[model samples]
Target chain A: MYSNKYVTIYTLVMTVIVSVLLALLFSGLKPIHDANEAVFKKRDILKAIEEYLPKPLDEMSDEEVLAMFEEQIEQQVLDAEGNVIEGIKADEIDLAKEEKKPVDERKYPVFIYNSDKGKLYLVAVRGNGLWDKIWGTIAFEEDFNTIAGVSFGHVGETPGLGAEITDNPAFPAQFKGKKIFEGDKYVSVSVVKGGVKDPEHQVDAITGATITSNGVTDMLKEGLEIYLPYFESQKKS
Target chain B: MSEVATKKEGLFGKKERKMLIDPLNDNNPITVQVLGICSALAVTTLVSKALVMTIAVIFVLAFANLIVSLLRKGIPKQIRMIVQLVVIATLVTVVELTLKAVDYPIWKELSVYIGLIITNCIVMGRLEAFAMANKPWQSFLDGVGNGLGYGIILILVATAREIFGKGSFMGFQIIGPSADYLIDTTTNPWFSWYMPNNVMVLPAAALFVIGIIIWIQRSRNPKLIDIS
Candidate 1:
């Protein structure tokens, strides 16, 4: 039998060994992990313009996505007032963390996917879902008013219900061609229950997912408001 | 103690082979012992998710068993459980990191389940029950056996759920577009009748499927049933 003192010594030695091993393994894998995360975020951004994609999101390889993103997408970090912030990469900013800060202090990322057809402005937004956080990228066309497309993601939501905001293609598809502006007034799109009566400013909410639908509505209204100043400046220029 | 501990068996001997084979059927980790049922329920919603999780568990369990078997003697009696836990946790983390690095899509769908493997009882149960008393080779086989046992049930449950619940296999729609075999949606847009069983998509469905599997498995093998 192992003595108490021996047990303590063995435990300390094993703990030290395990800690060192884990630390080394984590450090060794950090680069690949970071690269994968980068590509995943890029893929999500590209998902916003899935219609214009050369191939479907599932068909395109990570390298292809990274390559397409590198070639066509230009990223800019902007302050609340719409001024471009230098020395910061758009992808590096964590929108969920940024959402917690005051509006003036947050640095917003704008991803512009440019091609011969036109330029699409993708803005990142994050807000509370029924259970946890939900975030997405909403892309705007050259007109800077109508939505080109949108792709939403969630941390955790009720599967088959609230989670359909991401899982169901129809939910996001409705946002296409929907306007963020009602002729010069900033009227962000609403996810209306029962049905969307207005063609421009309203989208159909998921029938069983009122809270998550409302979350999207609130996220769109507030999340897009931060980008208003930037959109206004773009329209003028 | 050393003499009894070092009674090494042949690499592929009968005992060692049984260690690998027994968990698959009569002594299954899921169906017989009913360990690791939580993950089975969580990941079996999709076949692809279940398969990926099974593979991850296989890697973590096999290596953790081998390493623990190798270090069985040196592990202090008072801290043996802690030692086993540390080893399993280390392997699980490595598997998680590798999955994140190489197969990012599977990792995305699997999400927290890979991390949750560390909590799965089968991994710890093998390390304690078999690896502690066996040679490294046999311990490795035991890990493989239990992993496969857990995996088989998961795949069966996932297949049932995916087919009935989602009407799909690994996210591909297996059921024909419409119950009417000749209907073309592009031309008419009004001729489609394939409704997925919403109940099958839920976690409760996994429990039902697992219950059926256990029932069938036990019915065939009366020895697996405990009268006591």
Candidate 2:
């Protein structure tokens, strides 16, 4: 039988102790956690150009991924007007937070991978999926119209259906060699169900995941259009 | 409660052993008592996800039990539940932080479920039913037993779902189309005709697997059958 005074004291002490312990653990582990996240982002970015890497992304260690990102990838941050924004690392820009901003005010991060053949530009995109947010890094050939490769990520989507966009290699593989421009018109690749009539710009969607497939379609159209100006400016130069 | 002159039951006596072993079968947290079913259905889609959930639950449950049992005598009856929750929440946070630091990808996948562990009834249930009334060591054993009980069922359902649903185990393709499977359905004589059942991949399918488990368990152990 605890008195009111004792109960109050007990609760206070427990709360204080727990809070202190949690705060300590959180602060202590923050650096390592941040590093892990950075490595994860770098790894995903590199996955867009995985074929060009000397070793498979899976085989590469975290250090190697970071080193490869540093050595091979050039970071660029672009405004809606396609002007390069200086003084910020591309990976440091949080796309989710940027998504919350107004369209013209948001900044986009681009990762340029220097390969033996040419420079493959990787741009990050985020949009809504059936259940939650889905994002991807798209790699484009120097011409900025032909897709070199792609790697997708999702917060929450039905596994084996919508999640196949990331889980199944075949899904992302379809983007390879796909053209995003049709004679100077910026027409981002579309995820088509039933059939793909345009072999160069349309790919088959995951079966039974029509909403998520459509989400990808809409995401690519809007996400890629934002970079049309940047691509155009780079093409002229 | 007096300390009477009696035979000292060493560290792990028969009673303690029961506390550790009973939950694995007769007193299973998932199949028998039907506690923590929400997570059982959600995380069992993948063996890997279920395994991570199991480990996280075990860590939280065992530590929560130990801490609650240790403080049982000092805890006020009026605020015991809140105290228990704080303990569980702290441990769950620890699991989340550690998982993020150690494996970001798995952390990303299991993020929501890991946070939900704070609300997992089994953790609170054991604290209320067993830990508050038991010795620290015995309570710890009860926690582990229940955790393992929940884990056994979780892994079983995940294995059934993943194998039948996706033709894979722990993300390794075992049986499916001939392209990349370890056991190529096109070439493997045994599974040549076997096609993955799409129904098993759905979250609703976990309920069926759990229902079958409960049915078989009750049938085999007549004591578990409801007579009322």
Candidate 3:
């Protein structure tokens, strides 16, 4: 049994040594960690144009994917008023942080992927899910109204039900060719209940997942509205 | 095991090897002692998930054991528990950061559970029971054995659950799609060939599987049975 004086000294020395060791370990690992994060984000963004990639997404190595991103993708960080902010990389924008800022002050990143067929503009969106935050990248065709593809991800949702939005491909596939604007009125898109009778503006809601469905609906309406100014400017030009 | 003399066991001596092998069967951390069951149930839904969980547990348990064994002599009697906790917590954080930076998706799926590794009784149990008394190398082997012991069971249960529940093994579709077996009206679909057992996906299924394993283990090894 250690004496009280010995115990106190031992504790202090152990704590100091452990703390310093951890600090050094963390600092050394930070760059590789950050690089992994960047690659992950890039992969998610690239996933939006998965169908258009030269080879299957699964077959492509990290270097290949990064090369594709550099060669075929154009990055832009946009202000709320549709101005292109220079000097800031699109990948550096953290939507979670931007979500906390005032609407006008928030920055949005757009990834334009050039495929052999045409150009695809991918926009990032984030919102609350049933349990936590859900985010996605929705890619638009040149017309800016027709959805080319979409990729949704979530923090936590009911694994069997609400999670179908991400886990089930049919849910996202239903968005293809679904128009975002009905003759400039900006109807966005709806996650409809019962059935999606109006094919152009709605997709079938996840059964028994009303809250998550509503969350997606709200996410799309608000998330798409943020990029309207930039769309309008592009249309004018 | 107690009859073995207290002579210093060589690095891979018979006694030291028993420390590693015993936990796999007769002294399993999960089945025999019934420790760390919560994580066994939660993460074993898929073989892939269970595999990742296993690797993470192995890393944390081995390192935590080593650190505790090294500090065993100097640690105060009054603050021993706290010291073990601090060591375990530090190791868990390191595992978490490495997972986050290296494999973000699995880390995301195994999220919260990694933090809960600090609470895993197996890690703390080894620190107090074995590491505190044994040499550093022996303690390390014990940790690995227990971690692997826990992992093997987890993988078996997860494989069964995923196959029965999802009709997939590690995300690959082994069974044909449900749409092919639709035999009912548009509103309510019934399967003609086979339907995935929805119950298997729930956490409760792991309990039954674990129970069956214990039954088999005890039946084969009669010495494990206890009767009053």
Candidate 4:
């Protein structure tokens, strides 16, 4: 039987020891963890234009991914009015954090891939999925309406269903070459269930995942609409 | 000293061997004891994920058991459960941080499940039922045996799910459409009629697989059958 004093002392010592150990480990490995996360984000962004990359995203080492970002990719931060916000690297902008801010106050991150052909504009967007937040990086051709490629990511969507947006290659493949503009109006792209009637503006949705499909549609409509101003400015320049 | 020498069992003696091997079958964690099923269902959708998860659990459980057994004397009975929790939580965090630094993709895939290991009943159950009353080496073996027991079922369930559900084994397409499969179903002429069952991909299917495993295990080892 432990006396009250003994029990208190035991608990105090145990708590202190566990906290110190965890705190030391966490601080010691913080740099590596941060580096890994940075590379992961870069990989996801690059996955949008995987077809244009010199090598497959999976085959590239972390150092290679970082080097490619440093060499071939130019990043920019933009405000709601389409003006570039200087001194902030595009990769530094956390879209998840930005999503929490007021719509007008949010900053968008754009990655421009300098390929031999031309500059491909990649933009990030975040929205709600069936279970949690869903995000995607969409790349547009120089014309700014044709989708060159897209790569989606989700936090907690169901496996084999909603998560197919990221897991299945075929899902993102549907967006390739799809036009987001009808004449001059911004229609974005729709993930239509059943059959895609408008091949120009619609893609077939994932089977049995209506909410997530709709989430992607809504996310693209609202997400791409914000960047239209920036695209217009870039086209003018 | 002579009495102590006489009492000393060899390192891999009968009792120690029992501690290591019992949970593999008769007292298996998942199939018999029915612990740690939450994570079993969640991460077994992919064999790679399940394999990584099993390694993480084995590491955590073995260390947690050894530490708890070593501290069993000093851990106040009034706060034993809390002490056990603290130890398990610390081990889980360690695994999480290390995994994040070493294999970011697997860490991302197993994001929440790694953290949920702190609540895994098998870890706590062993600490309370076995570690608290056993020697350090014996408790360590017990922990490993139980983790292996849990892992066996996890990998088995994942194999069934991944193969039947996705027509893949550890991400290699084994049988499916001609475009993805290793053995082109379109031209294979043998598996052309087989389509991957989507139900097996669902989390509910893990329960059915586990149920079948439990049934098979109990049927073979009648001693494991519940009389109650």
Candidate 5:
């Protein structure tokens, strides 16, 4: 038998009560968290290819984002061999999980944008960076080789450094119009630490963020390399 | 925290002096002590966002500290930290939910960081060291003081970074609207200062600023030079 004060019944009761309250709190906010994620994903997709969308991003609504994305775009699901994976919905493929699958088994979703110039292809890229993870949507020209626009996001990197992958506008902006394949060997866009004198391939990397710059370069090379066959076949066909 | 606030009611009214200086100089969470620097560096790129986040963090820290101090007697010593965590987490949840309801835009910008406040050492450290043994009123003051202290440094850092970084205070383009005015070296958006020392945008900058603060604080009070 125990003296209740020694047991600290009040403390125990409050603890249980607080824990339940916390459980309820987390449960209640689950929807909001999901909504925030949805918004974030929307923002990412929009930012990935926002060059085509009209400006004043604040005025743009979610419904409009979805509508613009739907009206101006068509999705193609492809297997690693560059063959169309029919009956598999591109929208249904979970991109976050898809990267984990063997490159061949993965559902590679391409957004075919019907722009004024022609069709543009957006490829999703995911890879490990020096700090944590880095991923992006690289929109390609109809040639399926030149980058039209690109946007990247990262996790747990130093701010102003690795986070420059997203926070610094220049990093993402650098990918625009950069050719991924010069002749044959994959020359994915490179991040140059100092202002790039070599205009053909490198974008000036964030100053003092060289390691992060290299991390991004590696991720781009690694993540984008797997999709080369897919793009190459498209180009040839 | 309240009890500790009243601890040495002797010289120069420590409460009065501490309240004014805790956030301003001596015990600053951002500049000097360098504890809660994550939100400061990352979010300061946008002035409005930085301001909103500053206010939210202030609110959360102050209230959470107050509640924890009030309920300190009821918390089991063995599970004291666990109790503090629960309390901080619950308040964070509440702050997050309230943001979602009230200011949706600020909510969108700051919600992720708000949840992260639970990890901010300033809140827990103050609660355990000052509030747990102190009285409620004084603990509340300590929390408010510390949060404000953190906020002041955040605002100063953010204001400096955002204005210079974007050449736009908040969203209003302080610089000329034309593309000619923007600093994009490569192409259109002119992204130079926006790209400078990405360190400025990360939490490390907070550490950098905090180092300066410690230097300033020490310089001011030769007495505080000793190991307390």
Candidate 6:
């Protein structure tokens, strides 16, 4: 058993060979892994439009999803001033990287889309929820103050509560067409409990999901707050 | 007693029942043994996704076992685990790719969960404990059975959760007014057969359902109970 000079040589050789094999295997699969990730992200974006997707997601063709998104959406990158921030694609902007720089240097990416009603604005937001990181693309109406639509996804959170803020439809849709500003006031739409009685500036918090509703409420206040200055500057112009 | 014993590779013979049924009841990896289930908790809310995950795990386990068995002799004792990981990772990659090309949408839903299968203790558990010392065929069957056992629980939990908790099966309104409600405004007004309980949709529900499954499975078959 103590043949250090004998069997040990075989162990070393085997280790090297196995390590090489692993490298080769990972290299081959890396492309597929990358492709899968890309597709998954694209699919998440498409999920925002599932109601209007015109087919069951599983049965819906990829070409159909792509065609619908392309026909409906146009991408734009804006600065904190609401002026067009050229020379950068929306997806390429890493706010975490930009956060270290001056706010003026940061480019805020926005997505513009159209339905039969009119135009919609999507602002990409990344912030802290309760447990882990939370991210979403919130759409605003042509008026620049009313919310058109919103979608959220998170790394980890209490299920049925914080997580439902992402998975539950009734929760996200509540923000639809809700005014972020109350007529010459930037009070912003609040996530009110029981029900959002104010038809103009409030969305009802999710029933049975309070902490998550609070997460959504706080995240909205904080996330949307970043764009308030830009929107205000645009209105004055 | 025999010289062939020194040369013997497969410590256990490869039989269909041993590989399949062992993990299910006699050697249940989850209930009695209690292993590998981070994903099981979340996906069990819907039968379709849970079923897909089950099949995917089965594919990974069987193939990982077979490969591990084939290479058990060649693997260096020091780096054997790393090799097993490589094989397992490769198999996971293949499964993930196949899912994307064929069923992109469900593949999307399953998302990163597919790659996480590589970390499933059940696959590694069977490969290390039985398959590594067994014949290829035997190891393959064992993987298949264990995967089935896991799937059985997932499907049961998902079916129960989706039908009762949400009132719909596979995201469709199955038990709407057309079925039994049938135009009763006051008595059967807006009856949501499936409210999609925030808890049930979450993975913790899987643990509760699995607990019930073990309780029932053991009560019916006392021998299946793990006293220890």
For chain B alone, what TM-score does every candidate structure achieve against the true structure? 0.88, 0.93, 0.89, 0.94, 0.78, 0.83
For each of the candidates, give the backbone clash count.
Answer: 0, 0, 0, 0, 15, 9
Q: Write the per-residue lDDT of candidate 5 for residues B1-228, one digit (tens) a residue.
A: 334445567433667567646666666776556677666766766668777777777777778778878887766677678778878887887887767755565775576788888888888888788778877767677777888888877777776665555555666555432453444434545543343333445555655655665677778887656733
Candidate 3 residue-wise lDDT, B1-228, digit = tens: 122333665578887788778888889999998999999989888899899999999999999998888878888989999999999989888888888877877887897998899999999998888889877887888899999999989999999988887677888766535342223222343434566676787789999999999999999988888821
Candidate 4 per-residue lDDT, tens place, B1-228, comes to 011121467777777787778888788888888889999999999999999999999999999999999998889999899999999999999999999999998999897999999999999999999889877887888889888888888999999999998889999989876577787778788777888888898999999999999899878878777631
Please compute DockQ, using alpha carbons, for every candidate against the native two-chain complex. 0.63, 0.78, 0.51, 0.83, 0.28, 0.26
lDDT values for all models: 0.85, 0.91, 0.85, 0.91, 0.71, 0.70
Residue B18 in model 4: lDDT? 78
Model 1 agreement with the true structure over A1-237: per-residue lDDT tens digits = 898888888888888988898899889989988898889988888888998877799898879988987778898999978788999889888987887898779899999888567989999988889999999899999888999999999987877678889877878999999998887798999999987799899999986789999999999998999888888788789
Stretches of candidate 2 exceeding 4 Å from the true structure: B1-7, B186-192
Predicted model with the maximum DockQ: 4
Docking level of model 6: acceptable
For each candidate, give its TM-score against the true structure.
0.91, 0.96, 0.90, 0.97, 0.75, 0.79
- What is each model's TM-score for chain A? 0.96, 0.98, 0.95, 0.98, 0.83, 0.80
Distance from true location, Cα of A111 in model 2, Å? 1.1
> Candidate 3 local accuracy as lDDT?
0.85
Model 3 residue A7 lDDT score: 85
Regions of model 1 farther than 4 Å from truth: B1-10, B176-193
Identify the superior model by lDDT, candidate 1 or candidate 6: 1
* Candidate 3 collision pairs: none
- Among all windows of 10 consecutive residues in model 1 chain A, the one with the lowest summed lDDT is A155-164
> How do the residues B125-222 of candidate 2 rate in per-residue lDDT, one tens digit apiece?
99999889887887888899899999999999999999999899998888997689988888888888998888898889999999999999998999
Order the candidate numbers by DockQ, best to worst: 4, 2, 1, 3, 5, 6
